[model samples]
Target: MGAVTRLFELAAGADRLGLAVTRIGLVVVLVWIGGLKVYHYEADGIAPFVANSPVMSFFYADPANYKAHMNPEGAVVPANRAWHEMNRTYPFALGLGSVIVLYGLLIALHPVLPQAATVGSFLVAVMSVVTLSFLVTTPECWVPDRGGPEHGFPLLSGAGRLVVKDAIMAGAALVTMADSAKAFLRRRARRTPAEVPSAGAVAA
Candidate 1:
């Protein structure tokens, strides 16, 4: 069969549409989280959601300042109290957020849809790992006060729901990755014998 025909055949059978749908969904999630980060930086409303607790305080404090330091240029800025807090606990959020945005745009616009999805899936897998780790470490909600008369203990609570959600997100990412990988390998397999030249030809 012709190369173009074979290429189409290889790509035609896999769940490309499903992959695209999930990829777009993943992008939406990324964009949401990215916006959250931006809000934490720019708006003060996010403070209450994460205020006065050791676990989530940094989330409320100067979010923009926090995000600013995460950029490549922001790397050199001396670490202060806010940067130290968020960077220490949720260190991957900034880089992962930026990557997600880029991946989303590429998948949405790239001419090579298959390749974009494949690469985007891999990046989403990385994000899933980070999300899973956060789910493991932090509780969803803590007592607003550190040392109230009711119970002075540094209570950690509500981690279960967040964990479940994050687990779902991670699973979605894994499925997306698997679908993309299958598409890639199927395309590779459809290559003609001449396309898979000997090692000598590859070297030459």
Candidate 2:
């Protein structure tokens, strides 16, 4: 029983390091995935999600027409590629990727710049919220009925499974934000001067 309690204490002691590692892990995910968006296949892969999003559709020249030009992963359909070029799909993806990478880098400075990490973690949380909405707004998140009884609600397609994992990131972002905010306050407090009680207050 004493040894078990010691193990629990050890885990508690490592919590701060765990949070720091988690921040780095999230940075790795954002940088790698965001960097991939600059590639043809990666940009093409995200079209369905972007086109289906009402909030994002404005970036495309003709969001409604995207379905007809849908290309599978690594597919090199000239016609579809041309259509995407017209829609500025690649450009939009590149810009979004830059923003994602920037956020990751901002969070990476958590140790010395808690203020930046707070802002970055907040942005990540907002981004995750938008991503999670894809499950509702994007039909492709669920398996389409091709005469299969296992299609639709409660049945996640591969994309849906991937999007759902953003929930963890969202939660982690909040945790990181809170930690950074607390750290910022601690720094501020250290720099602040202590208040001295007036004589009347001291007498009370």
lDDT of each: 0.53, 0.92
The per-residue C-alpha lDDT of model 2 at residue 116 equals: 96
lDDT per residue for candidate 2 within 93-196, as digits (tens), equals: 99999999998988988889999999999999999999999999999899999996899998999999999999999999999999999999999999999998
Which residue pairs show backbone clashes in model 1? Answer: 40-63, 41-63, 41-64
Stretches of model 1 off by over 4 angstroms after superposition: 1-20, 41-96, 106-113, 139-160, 191-204
lDDT of 2 at 56: 96
TM-scores, each model vs. reference: 0.48, 0.93
Runs of candidate 2 exceeding 4 Å displacement: 196-204
